[model samples]
Target: MGPSRLHLAQGALAALALGAAVLLQGQAPAASASSDNLTADRVENLRLGGDGVAQRRHMWTIFADMVSDEEPDFVHWQGESGVFGAEAAKRPSGIQGFQRPKSIGGDPHLIGAPIIAYNLFNPAAFAHIRAQGLYRKATLDRLQLTGGTGSVPPFPAAAIVIKTAWWPVAPEGLTAMPVWDPELNPPDPTGNPYLGWARVVAVDPTNISQGKTAAVQFVGRSFPGARRVQLEAFHHVAVDAAMAKQLAGDPESNRTAIIALGRPIAVNDQLALVGINVMTHEQQDWVWGAFWWHDRPEVGPFAADRPSTLPGPWRNYLMQAAFDAKTPRASDAGAHICFNPWLEARFPDGGQGGGTVSNCLSCHQRASYPAAPFLPVTRGAPNLREDPALAPDRLRTSFLWSLTLHAQRD
Candidate 1:
């Protein structure tokens, strides 16, 4: 698991490149899967076995448990409250209310739809941070060793963290349920797969105009009455107009798109959950999984072990997982690639010019107090044993970037 050179077959590399290309085009590839869907009893299995498919299925079980409505929505659990505004802090009842995503960062904005995001911590994660007083930058800096590689203790086995991306239906005031237009997305201009394959969604012009709703409209191909079906089912939260305006403020271009979509905004406007990144420290290296909304949820390796118990909108998401830096022994040994198209597709490697393949466990492994750059220093497969992004001088953050990036000064 430590830094070691990995030699992958040319064919496997090509497959990953092809997969990435298909995603950029905004079209999901056809499925070729085995019968690995999970059941209620299987949800308890957390071991990342040697088999890649089984490991991914194990991750799918974790995803199902996280999104289960039997418990409070992840948004209501607890946020990385040490950040600015403290708007995401938990309520007296222990339910952390929703907060507007501060920035789009490197995430991609979908056609006709601009993206927004927020992060939350499970009880175990939040408690560990609070108990250790790790929310303060000073605490992290002080923990850095005067000598030796300053690796901090890892979080407990039960700790979990989530970063969710959303589609903000705009106009600040428009709460009308919107429809999904299959044709509205721009066609893949570059027919060659390398440039990207499917058509990206089209931007809705009427929704972007400042304060004007002369004719609220969706610009792409029409999907009659399919309003909330494809993406409508995911859990959503209300965002007031004031906050919506603030989130849409920076990128003048996104300002409009953020306000136009259907759902909620401004007390009434609701944003749909488009994709999410889930990290569970169930194992030492930590098991990583990402889920993105897909019109066709029954295809691909990510869709392999989806359980029927995953209610409504949760079933619409397609997931991929990584239990190690290199592929599991059961699969062709290659750089494991798992990322949410909605979350990491736009950027090269999770961010900047990093690696050819994106690995969530690998990326988060670099989370350190002196804070390593979001982009991994190593190219291709990152060494899980000895991370280049994490130096001995810095304190590791147990793979939680929210702790490293969002923790504020006291």
Candidate 2:
């Protein structure tokens, strides 16, 4: 598929921003979830009327509530071990546990390092798998080839999937850096890290269907083939600034570093809301949402007219949808959250480049199972449409590649 007209439209917007002499500066004031732009009333109205912005705002509200302990709660903490509190599946243990490689860095089988995921299906939608024992490889293979409603059954509205990472914890205000040891399939128990936060991607069928028309008009993109809309949210548990500083200074090394800097101070606090990524069928790319906490003085504010910058402390907490792929520039993009610049910096060619320009949708658009042989280490975007290996016939694992683990043999 050639670049859609939407791409061209985004380019035009970028041109306009570049040509302007007096660019907007400072940051837009933060808006409360109940504000006019993101009011609960507006969300309900948009849900009923089928507005894309409403869908984005509504999802943002839900995520905000999760982090802020707000009203109309839709998410809750389920703890570190196991899936939703159930003992983690032991059969698919070892390298076959979850297929997707670590989102940040390290080997696919390593623990402590961040891991990619697509397995989180809401109870209603996941019931299909449970009822039919689809978690089994044999059953999952059959379902992938000839099951579900559409090419992929729309995750029941509100169904959520997550990508999570753990931070090293220590008592004497010091801890060894977590390393990837392939030989240690599940990693030594003591070497394992604790949960830092989870990045949530959820399906909202109603909003997706409604957003189709609105996206084309507002964002210059359209997803006519979309059966369900998806939104992304982030949850973070703060760490000590001293630990963060140590980790930030030498994320690659520094397995053992101490007494080099300041006192230990808390960084992230509790399981708080970070940001949200909203999508419209019109723009295959999604919109990013972030909180003031991620904002920086140099980067202006989160989602401000000016391009945002990633400084100390907030460097690791990167948000997707930070820039509009159409414009492909930080100044033109909206305020969004994504992976920390440090993490993206580790993999320059990887989807998360260490720059003002990044798009969660664009990066994830390449998500696939039985990924091309050159995947994992291959930086840059994969040619899904042109590459025969990625052809739909060869098993396009929808957007969640981790789900492939269900059918993967140990």
Q: Which candidate is the best by TM-score?
A: 1
TM-score per candidate, in order? 0.66, 0.43
Tell me the tens digit of each residue's lDDT in model 1 across 323-379.
Answer: 776565323345566666655544342232322245676567777776555753232
For model 2, the superposed segments whose C-alpha errors exceed 4 Å read: 1-59, 70-134, 147-150, 174-299, 303-345, 350-358, 373-384, 405-410
Candidate models: Cα lDDT each = 0.52, 0.31
The true-versus-predicted C-alpha distance at residue 3 of model 1, in Å, is 40
Candidate 1 displacement at residue 277 in angstroms: 0.4
Model 2 shows how many backbone clashes? Answer: 17
Which of the numbered candidates is closest to the native, going by highest lDDT? Answer: 1
